[model samples]
Structures are given as C-alpha cells and as structure tokens.
Target chain A: MSMPEGRMDEQTIAMRVAREFQDGMIVNLGGGIPSLACNFVAEGREVFFHTENGALGYGGTASLEEADWDLFNASFQPVTPLPGMSFFSHDEAFAMIRGGHIDISVLGAFEVSEKGDLANWAIGNMKDYNGDVVAWIKTGRFPPAIGGAMDLAAGAKRIIVAMTHTTRDGSPKVVKKCKYEITARKCVSLIVTDMAVIEVTSEGLVLKEVAPGLTPDDIQAVTEPKLIVADDLKEVEL
Target chain B: MNKVVASAREALADIFDGAVILCGGFGCVGGMPSTLLRALSELQVKNLTLVGNAPALGLEAQKTAARTMQVPESYADGSLLLKNGQVRKLIASVPAMAIYRLQEPFPIVKALQEGQDIEIELVPQGTLAERIRAARAGIPAFYTGTGTGTLLEKDKEVRQIDGRPYLLEYALKADFALIWAYQADRYGNLIYKGTSRTFNATMAGAAAVTVAEVGGVVEPGELDPEIIVTPGMYVDRVVVRQGETG
Candidate 1:
C-alpha cells in the first residue's frame, strides 16, 4: 500500500529555515533544501544566493529554458541567475567562500551529534574510498568538486543543517554522536527537522521548540537520544 | 616581543586617544581586524574616523575608552555611544541600508530627513574598493568612470580626464588597520588563505600601523612568496595569535 503524507512535511521545515535569513546575507544554499530556500526568502531580505558556477544574487527558479545551463546551485540543477550577478572560474569561486565572503551555509545532513558534528558527504568506509563521494553520485561534473564544504563547515558564521527529524525507518537522525564520517567537529549551530527546531549547545542537544501537532512527548519519544528541554521551550513558529 | 599581550584588553595599547582607522572585510570577512579590534577595548581609543564593510556582529563595538565619531551603520554597537551624544560626528555609506536592520531605521533617517546634519556619504561598492586601493598606493586621488555623469557626480568632484568629466575620488588611508590572517611570518609578511584576503590586503598597505592576529605563526622563509598577499614592509609591528583556530 502507498503511504500517506503528513500535514507538516519536510517542505515546511525548509521554509522555516529560509525565513531565518536576514538582509545582506551572502548565503550558500547546499544542493537540497538550500536550493529550495530561494522561494521562501522574504521579499525584502535582500539575500544574495550564490552558486558554484559564479552566479550571485540569484533567486526563485523559473522556466527550464530561462535557467543558465552553466550557472547552477551546488547540485548543478539549472537555476535562474539574479541581477547584479557576475561570473568567474569555479576554483576562484571557492576563494570567495574561503575568503569568508559567505555569511551562513544552510545544508542537508545524514547525522548530527550533540555538539553538531556533521557527516553529509561521507558516510561509507573512508579506508576504502578516495573521498570523491560527490563524484560517485554521477549527476554532473562538479568542477569545484564540493571543495568548500569543509571550509563552510568550519568558517561560515553559522552552519545550519536541515533534515527530517527521523529516517525513513523511523530512526532518529539526531544522536549522541553521528554514525557516519564527521564533516566538521562540533560545527552545527541549528538543526531544522519536521517535528522540531533544535539548537546545539555546550551542555547537550536542547529542545528549544517543537513543531505543530507534535507534543513535547511525541517528539521526545521518537528522538532516540534524551533531549534537554529548555525551561522556556515553545512551539516553533518559523 | 615588546612585552606583548593577547586578550582584547592588551591589544588596544597603541591605539591613540583619537585616531582614524579604515577596517577591512565584508561583514566579518575583512571588516574589522581582530588583534587591533580586540586591543581596541584596552586602548579605549576615543573619537575615531573609520571605514569599510562591517562584521556580522552589529555596528557598534565595546566603546570603553571613548566613542566613535559618526554612527556609520545603525547595527554597529559603537552607535550606542554616538547616540548618547558622546561622539562628534558619524558617517557611513548607504545610511539607509545601515539603519534598515535596526528597530527604527527612519528615526535616524528622519533625523537626516528633518535635517540632522546628514553626515552620511553613500558610496558605490566598487568605487569604495578603488579609493581604498588608491589611498594605499599613495596616490592623492584618481578618477573613475563609475560616478561621472549622473547623480553621483554632485557628491564627487567632477574632473576632466581625456576631455571627459570623471568623478574624482580621494585616496583613503588610515592611521591603523586591524586584520586577520591565516598565518604570519615573524618578518611581518602575511599569508591569507581562502576568504581572508577580501579587504585586508587593500588596508594592509594603506594604513600606518597594521596589526594582525593570525591563526598560525611561523618562522621566516617557511611560507611561499607566491601565496603572500601582503609584504612585510607595509606591516609595522607583528602580533601572533594566542590559540586561535579557524
């Protein structure tokens, strides 16, 4: 039998994170939810979305033909480049990111620890592979080759991961420590999930806010690891 | 070492009671130099002229010694001092954009609208970079094709270049420049890897004293010259970092 979709789905979580963006943000939206973020950025936020192919100030995807074939998000998905945008070599592109021009990096993740360790790119046995997992996906040529995730994970003012609270098999993606390879050591600042909004802290993973129709218990039960509930935990609006 | 100190308190020592500083960076990238900025609290330096992009850390910084001149951007923590009438003047580019992030952008705008001396000077991004470069290069001023024939012409000195009127912009230099670097040789040569080069390189040559806090400190001759963006001649005294990562 086909499964039914829930009311507050993953897309809702994506929008919630997008709204957090403020004016003058030079944000790098990763391949997944990050790319979707353009639709939700508020009308006046004035965020300049950057892609690997040297396009900046891009937003809101339009007709497929109108999209720049060469200018795409991290995933190489055809996207519309915004105005006041410029183009440059892909390697030079990473220089801008490495130069600390980016404000926030909103990404997708497979696992996260209480301290916000990330493991998005590599989860398989590293002893065996050469660390070209992005190439293994075979979508398109990644000229820059995901060159800056490590830098982004380390240098960006904030690193926010957006993912479903649980895995398809009902397993909690949030754990005491991630099972996959660590992308960054204790780098996560925020995690937006379908059921809740969590902020990583020194003490432990704290449940700052819960999602709609999800009681504290409902989220708590599904979350394998015990979460520290802030004294003022409230329902997450965005 | 000149009995060197690290923490923000110790770093501000040489910052005079009154000085003009042109910071480097876009937002946190090159905006404010760390060691100098950190030391600023200790210097408690008062009444200053400054320029450049701002760090994401709002507009004002801890103003213990004294307050900054003009409230460049509203979010600047330093503006608190300016608003209290502690400062004499405040200036910034895109004062409207600066005040936009605040609780009330227009009160400042209204002050400018209702006549509050309107000390703001709106400058184009590329022109700002060019002027800073010319200032560092020791040129008095240069003309650019950017603001020559339009509304920007009124703000700038319209000069004839090749029989055409071009906007004349003066070179902008600073008494001190605070910067961040990936690593520094004891000789004062700076190597900025990744996004660290933004405005820091331009300000390095433009300032009288450039103080840098690097993530790593190394002996001379270790770093590749090709990677060195700023030579040691431009940097005055070098201050290595005390346990900084990323």
Candidate 2:
C-alpha cells in the first residue's frame, strides 16, 4: 500500500495531529505517541498544555546550560515553560482535569474497541517463580492506581486515541472487543492508527479513510471486527 | 474539624455541593482517607469533580485480574458516597479496567457508549509528590522534570531547551484533604506505615484544610522527629481509628 503524504513517519503523524488543535484549547498529551503533537503546533496558537507532574509554562528540550534538575515532566524529561503559564498543587492539576477546564486530552491507548472503549492501564497476569496469578503491570503496581486515565477520559470532552491499529502479530487493532481490560467505557473519540484513521461512532467503526493504496476492503479483511466504509471515501491525504 | 461530621449518617457535613476534593491512597497500601469517602456517600452530592489514583474496589477483586471485554466494577468508595445519593457528578482517573487494562479503559468506554462525561488527568508518581510539596510550602508553583515530551505538555507554559517539549503540571491544593496515616501525636505530627506515604505526605500539607485519620494517636514527642514524616505545623486535626482500619 502506498503511504499517505505527511503520514509516512511519526513526525508526519505529529504534524497531522496538530491540525486538529483549536486555538485556546486546553489539552493533555499522554506519553509516547501523544507527546509528538507538541512540536507541530501552529505558531501563535494558544493551546495550554498541562503535565500532570507540574509546570504550566514548561516546554521544549533540556539544555545543558539551562537545565534545572527540579524542572521536568513525569518521565524525568526536561521541560521549557511558556509565558502566561501557572502552577498549582498536584491536586490542583487533577482539579483542572476534574473541573472541566480542559477541552481535549490526546492520549495513547493499548486496545480500542470498535465501540471506542479504551484500556490504557489494566494489568494482566505475570508469572512468578511459582507461576502464581499476580497482576502484570508496566509500573510494578498490583491493584495499581487506575491513575489519571479515567479522570482524563471522563473530564475531557474530546478524547483522541493514538496507537497502532493492531498488535505486532498483524491483528486488527480496531477490534470488535478488546482482549485486555477496559478502563473507560466507549471513551474514545478518534482512533489514529498506522494503517487507517477510524472514528468510533454509534454506527460502529466508520472507516474515515485508509492510507493511500490500502482499500477499505483491505482494511476490513485484516480487521477481525466488521467495519463500515465511508461512501466516496478517498485515500487519507496529508 | 470535628464539626465536619458527627456520625456515619452525617459524614459529609463539611463538604459543600460541587466541592473538588482529593482522595488519598496507593492501591490500599498507604493510608487512604476513608472518613472523607464515607462522608461523600453521606452527603450524596452529585455532579462533583474528583481525582485520585484508582477507584475504590472491594477487597475480593483487589487481587483478581479483569477478564477480557469491558467490566465496570462498583467503586467501593463511590458506593458509600452514592448510597447517600450525594454524588451526582463524578470524575476519576480509572474505571475498573484502568485498574488493569491500559489500551482500552472500561468505565470511560461504557460512558462513551452512552456519551457520558468522563474527565481523566494522568500524573507521574514522583512529580505528583513534588507538586504537592510546592503547594504545602505555599509556593505558587514549582517545576518538575517529568512529562515534558509526553501527555503532561498540555496547559503547561513550556520551555523548549533541547528539542523536547516539557510541559507544566501546576501544584494541586484542594479545598479539603482527607488522608490516612499510621500514627500521629496530639500536636499533629503524623507518621505512615510502609508505602502509605505515597500521596498522604503531600496531601497532609497541600490542602486548605487537611484532617488526618490515624491508626494510633499518641502524645506529642512520643515519636522521634526523624520518624515523623509530616510536622504538626502542616496538619490541622487528627482522628484516631479505634481499630486497624486497613
């Protein structure tokens, strides 16, 4: 299949994601794929970004000369604070989320249902020496804190999920149902995968568009769940 | 502080309608504010904004992994608040699957299926602490080294130094903070057992009004200063649990 313009790499995806940004929208970019959107934001656009860890004016890379050990994000990454940004208590960050001040939250999801349910922080079983049933978590938490995914999904009016359409095994990511646990119920608003862009609507997985050369039939055939193709759907262009 | 609640029936006396509160816990390891959660149920305040790490679940499922597909469990804490019919508006970080599932969230997905309003704010563990510290210290805000090129970028006044986007998460101080601790002196110097220190330490100092519930209330100076995690100056009141609550 031919690749779509500005969709060939993560940078392209980052650029495309930036297009969806509305001026003055308060948004949160999750780790990994979601973070890519920061670089592509249009100049003079007033998008206020809040890192859950703390810093309203935090921005771009850590400079060897200007780096402050205390000023960084959740991943211990260096941050640059923009003008007019403010900080509050950690709970205030959650308050900002819980208070309905945020307009959009761009997060990464592991499994997205055809119905748009998102499972971003559930733990599977891990094998111990005895192979006893234990919570398998990325952060070593059993009965882990469901953390902020639920709050972000519930609080934000617009939730955009960015992840591959399927796992490495070539299975369809836009599935009929998820194999992992579900954190938020049908909380996904948009699904941007490597192969296609899907919108989870009441009508089901509406095929927004597939990359160039990849037909709706091709996407559907690879998909385990049934898919709906948009009439007169064209290739996803940059 | 005692005026906040007189009994289980009126546990939510201090909480006004539409108040934003913080629920402190670490997957049941640390001292969680049970009294406050109980109060939420007693008041039955609906359409409220809330934040925490995980939904309070029954002990039965604490060790059980969720089966494939979507399943939303009753939030044990919310259940208590809901029992009183006070929580009309609610927001949290995770539903049931947020307890285990990552890619797909259950509570949010179910809400999405019906178009429910769900708001989630994700925070790193350590950065959360530092921000809380900044609040208690009365600093307008401080900087953390987490969530730069990631989700934390939103709402942050950013400083791009090395081709990375490091966002700001403002310090969070709420109207009321209810936290759990292992012990506290009459003067309010509190101590926690094990990892219970997670969010409680910050909550102790950050809240406008912080009432600490402890397993044991001892006399001041009974404990060593080195062992005391929260100084009495930060704590407003202390209520000791008759028995081990956890």
Candidate 3:
C-alpha cells in the first residue's frame, strides 16, 4: 500500500496534543510522547503538571548544571520546581489522581482500540522452538509492568492517548481491538497520532484532523478500524 | 526520648527472615534508604517480601546518574536484596526488569525464568500507595475505581459505587519499613527534601517498625513542628547515615 507523505513527527504530535490543554487544568503526562506535551502547552495558560512520583506543579526538566537529585518527574528525569510547586507522599499524589482531581491525563499507548480501550504496558515476545518461531509468550520472557497508567486512565476526568499512528514495523496502532494487555477499558477519549487526530465518540472513531498533506482515506489506509470523518475535518495544526 | 540509632546495621538488627519490608523510594537514589538497604544486603536476611513502587530500584539511579552526570554517593536499592537472593516476592507497580531495557532481565526475572520460587504481584501504583496508606490509617479495606474491569480486579470483590464499579483493595501492612529522609529530630519527626518524600512519608507509619535513614539528626525543637512531614509518633527508629553530619 502506498503511504501518505508529510507525516507529523513526535514533537508535532505532542504540539497537537497540547492544544487540548486548558487554563487551570491539572494535567498528568505519562511517559514517551505524552511527556513532550508539557513543553508545548500554550503560553500564558496556567497548567499544573502532576508527576505521580510525588511533586505537583513542577516546571520543565532541569539542566545538568541545575539538577537537583531529590526533584524529578515520573520519567526519573530531574525537574525544576515552580513557584507554586508542592511535594507530597505517593499516597497523596495518587489520591489526587484516583480521586478524580486531575483534569486530563495524556498517556502513551502501544495499542488503542476503536472502542476506546487502551493497551500500552506490555508486549509479548516471540519464542522459538526447534529452529522455528513458536508462540508469543508473556510469562517468563516478558512480565508486564502495570504502573500508574491504569489509575490515571480509570481515574482522570479525561484520557488522551498520544502515540505514533503505526508501530516501528508499520503495523497499525489504532486497531479494531487491542491484542496486548489492556490498561483500561473504554477510557481513552482522544487519540493524537503522528498521522491523524481522532476522537473516540459515542458513534465511532471520528477523524478530526490529518497530517498536512494526508486525507481521511490516507489515514484509513493505516488505521485498523473504519474512520468517521468529522464535519469540520482539517489538516493538523500546530 | 532519643530514637537515634548508631548505624543502619544496628537499626535493622531485629529484621528476621521471611519479613515483609516496605521499602521507600520511586526508583531513585534521593528517596531510597540506600544505607539501610546496603546493610540489609550484607546482613543476608532471606525470604523477604518487598513492597515498593519499583522493584529494580538502583538501576534507575545508575541510569539517571549516567544521563545527568550527577552520581549519588550510594546506589543501593531492592536490587541488592534480589541479587543476594534474599527477596522471595516483590509486590510493586513497576516490574523487576526495567520496562525500557527488556533485553536485560533483572535477577528476579532470571529466577522466575529459571522456575525458581519467586513471585511477583503487579499492583497499580495508586492502589499500592492507597493500600499502604489504608494500613497506616487503621482502615481494613477500601473501595477504589482505579482497577475496575482490568487484570487487577481479578478475584477481587467488586461493588458498584455511584453507578461505577469499584474494587475492594485490602490494606498492605508490613513488618518493617526502611525509609529515607533529609532531616529528623531526636524525637523522630522527619522532613524530606523535594520529591524524596514520595514513598518515604507514606511508608513511615505503615509498618510495625519504621526505621528512618536520615542525613542529619537534630534536637527536638530544631525542626519546626508545622513543617515536619512525618510526626515522631510514626517513626520508631532513626539512623543517621555515615559521613553525614548529625
């Protein structure tokens, strides 16, 4: 199949996702592409960045010269403290999340179903038997780690999945059904991918925006489920 | 009364085999009680059940230092216990193996692959924290919507709260808690620096014996009672790390 030209990059995808942020919203950015959205929030908008590790309202990551070992984000990178930043225990931090205080949670997913199901934590690796590849096993080879993703997905007021449209091997990430382990069922509200921006609605997966030169048909070529083009679908804007 | 102990080894002398330990930290050096973990590793206590956010903790510190070029004084974490074969089970949110570095399995994963008697229970990070908090607060169980319709709800009691499914999670109490703090008074009132307070403050009163590894110990009145994160009532013992001023 011929692919569309001018796909968005990780930064562009993050920039597109950041547009969803609003003033006074308490946002939690998960690992990978979701974490980049913290840097792209619109200027003059007051957003509180909550890291599940402990601190809330932290600013951008700290430089090596200004690094403080005790202060870091959920990704384990040293972060700079903001004026209103406050530190709490893990229980309090998770309470803020699981108590439905967080306005939005942008998470990175390996697979996001058309029904809004999320599967991002673990992937089974292939095992060979007698010089032939056998089954994709999860037990001994790849034990899945279910971190705060479930809590955030299930507890946050809104869940937005930020990821590339396709896997590294050119497989569709936005699928009819998630084959891997599910993080949460029908929790994702918005999906911002490198190829297209889709919203999980009551009707179906609604195609909201596509990459600069790509069309809805081009996005459907890669997506596993059929796309419902929005009434005002437009090219993805930064 | 002075709760200060001379060393980590002395503070953890009562830790026996088959003990349940709540180790504090978010997989980084600042929050981890490295001095106590190092002493625990050297003590060679076996069959420990560790509860924490990250099971393979020190590796994150090493990775962080490598990336930022700011090496901590010590990198001891739960891996030391796993390496010594002292941990029989790990109850944590993150796996023993680094999710990023799946090619290199940690000792816990290796033992599991070898069919050894090791168990891993992956709990969502929030549930784990709330369970520990529930234990400390004397709550037996609580209902939460954090793990509904997921693998975490398997065999767990589920009830509908406000038309939403909520899972009943039990308190996760422990035999001992090893926590790190920036400063503490002789009365055991603790204060942590920055994000180092993550699990350290949570696990303080959740265990039978809460041992704090602090950088410095001061007089009771030295610490402002209003600013102390953990009151002395929760902390049973306090040990100042070596090379740190008390």
Best by the DockQ measure:
3
Estimate, for each residue in B1-246, the C-alpha lDDT of model 1 and write its tens digit. 232234434454667645766555433222235444434533445665556543212342212101222222211333333333222233333222211233433223333333333233434444555567677777888765443332345556777768855567787766777666667777778876433455566667677777766666677789889777678876765565543322
Cα deviation of A8, candidate 1, in Å = 2.9
- The CA lDDT at B95 in model 2 is 34
Which has the better DockQ: candidate 1, or candidate 3? 3
Candidate scoring better on TM-score of 1 and 3: 3
DockQ class, candidate 3: medium
lDDT of 3 by residue, B92-184 (tens): 887543344533455566555555566667788999999999999999999998878666666899999789899999999799999999999
lDDT of all predictions = 0.57, 0.57, 0.83
Question: Which sections of candidate 2 miss by over 4 Å?
Answer: A1-7, A61-66, A123-145, B1-202, B206-246
List RMSD in Å for every model shown. 21.4, 15.7, 3.8
**Candidate 1 lDDT, tens digit per residue, A27-80?**
888756666777788776798887543456766764645643233444434456
Instruction: State the displacement of the C-alpha of residue A159, model 2, in Å, after optimal TM-score superposition.
Output: 0.6
For residue B147, give model 2's deviation from the true position in Å.
Answer: 23
Worst 10 residues of 3 chain A by lDDT: A129-138
Lowest summed lDDT across 10 adjacent residues in model 3 chain B is found at B95-104
Report the C-alpha lDDT of model 2 over B1-246, residue by residue, as the tens digit: 222222433433567676766666643322456655664565545655554554344333332432221122322354344334343333343333332434333333333234444343445544455566667777776554344433344567777647533445567667666677777877888877533454666677677777777766677679999778778877766765433344
